[model samples]
Target: DAGITQSPRHKVTETGTPVTLRCHQTENHRYMYWYRQDPGHGLRLIHYSYGVKDTDKGEVSDGYSVSRSKTEDFLLTLESATSSQTSVYFCAIRQGIGQPQHFGDGTRLSIL
Candidate 1:
């Protein structure tokens, strides 16, 4: 499991609402990432953090934002929920870019 944890294993919300997901890692890695899983497109990165308070946007970052205030904790927030954004969100952590990333169980979000 690589000591990674994700909260609210599942969630359901109405469109236009705000949602936040949390990821925690006990590995103390420098790199943390958030990704969304859809049926056909596989997994796509949403945001990532390289270190404490150091984060960057990923390919699909338009409606999503992320924060990492400490090495073990990373957060993902959806500013406005939408049906298009409803998917299984995953959190991963790695010691470095070249290293393998270990993923958390994931949080399944549904927008109604």
Candidate 2:
């Protein structure tokens, strides 16, 4: 999957806390995206970056933030963790438009 890796594959945290998930890639893709996968909602985009320091909000970005300081790393942070925010987060990287994205396994987060 183009050497994509998500850190802390599993995480359990309490409500009202802050949590951060990391996605790192070795392929030097110019576009990266963060998505949350829930049982019924399917994959919902949270945020995305087109290039270094250039990011935008997505469909489900209410409580989440993302940063891409370098070509190989993207960070997704939950401002304040909540039960509804618990889900499997996936990171995707694409070389450019019209190309297929390679995804990391995912980060399973639980909020109690």
Candidate 3:
């Protein structure tokens, strides 16, 4: 198993507020990613990290930010929450290039 854990299984916040979601892994994976799942777009990557303090933006990275300061932890932050940003967020970890990724249960976020 990947041994991944996502915090705050559910969240509801007002628009314009800042929110953060965290992902923790017990396995020492080298790569970690944050993705948001929506009805029409499927799964879209928000940000990813190759190593500690080495992070890059993904396809839908405009309103989101990510940080990875340790091997086991990846954090996703919304600069200012919006209704359009309301979706299920998932965190995945992979050992390397061709390895399978393991995902957490995901956090359900609702913005009103």
Candidate 4:
């Protein structure tokens, strides 16, 4: 949605390091999501939150963690950066199931 924003649109980190990315929304949507996109593989969900403090792992949950302490914010953390984790990460929000989800501009992460 127009109210959703992802911070530090770009980042570079070394392998084995920890990195955290933030997503902030003003729309007050109950559903928020984190996804990663890589060439050829398309988009993959990393994690999602149904509401404040309620989050679940997705298809690529390994090495990644997420937290949502308030309705307007969600955080994605990479426990240990890896070269394979380098990709464009995106944050999305929707009012409810079946509703169109709007996405924020992706964060491009590079692990050296």
Candidate 5:
């Protein structure tokens, strides 16, 4: 197993609604991340955690938030979603930062 899954591979939301996406990993990895992929930006990091409760925001963290309290699960929440937030969200993990990351398929999020 690749040790990961994202919930609701497809979604449609209004311009300003609260939405949450789930990322599940089976293998115990040391790092997990949330990233959004768009036509122009390619992939941009939203947030990540090195361990339980040891997370920090990333470059595109505005209006978005994340939490990881367990080794196998990471959650991303859009507090007040907007149309501009429509994009494919991917979850990733790495045994260590120096190495490449393994990514989940992706959660297709559409904020109206």
Candidate 6:
């Protein structure tokens, strides 16, 4: 089983507010992923890291950014969150792309 934790399980913020969500892993996995889930849209990748200090943008990376200074932690930041960004954000990690992913409880971010 994969062990992960996402902070601020739920949040309410105003439009244009700055927000940061954190993902922590205890398994010391090499690949970490950030995704946002919305109704009908399914899950869309935002950013991912292959290793510490080596991160890459994913399909839906716009309006979002990511950082990984340590192997066990990955951070996703919204410089200016808008209502369009409101959704459930999930964090995942794995050994490889084809490998199974373990997910966090998710952060329900709402921008009003």
Candidate 3 global TM-score: 0.97
Error of 1 at 16 (Å): 1.3
Candidate 3 differs from the real structure by a C-alpha RMSD in angstroms, to one decimal, of: 0.7
RMSD, each candidate, Å?
Answer: 0.8, 0.7, 0.7, 0.8, 1.0, 1.1
Q: Write the per-residue lDDT of candidate 1 for residues 37-68, one digit (tens) a residue.
A: 99998999999998999999998999998888
Cα lDDT tens digits, model 3, 24-108, are: 9999999999999999989999999999999999999998988888999999999899999999999999999999888999999
TM-score of 5: 0.95
Ordering by TM-score:
2, 3, 4, 1, 6, 5
Clashes (N, CA, C under 3 Å) per candidate: 0, 0, 0, 0, 0, 0
Candidate with better lDDT, 1 vs 5 = 1
* Candidate 2 residue spans exceeding 4 A from truth: none
Query: lDDT at 59 for candidate 4?
Result: 97
Better model by lDDT: candidate 1 vs candidate 2: 2
Angstrom error of the Cα, residue 86, model 2: value is 0.7
Q: What pairs collide in candidate 6? A: none
For model 4 the TM-score comes to 0.97
Once model 1 is optimally superposed onto the true structure by TM-score, how far is the C-alpha of residue 94 displaced, in angstroms? 0.3
**Residue 21, model 2, lDDT:** 98
lDDT, each prediction: 0.93, 0.95, 0.95, 0.95, 0.92, 0.95
**What does candidate 6's lDDT look like per residue over 4-105, in tens digits?**
989999999999889999999999899999999999999999999999999999999999999999999999999999999999999999977688888998
Which residue pairs clash in candidate 5?
Answer: none
Model 1 misplaced stretches (Cα beyond 4 Å):
none
Better of 2 and 5 by TM-score: 2
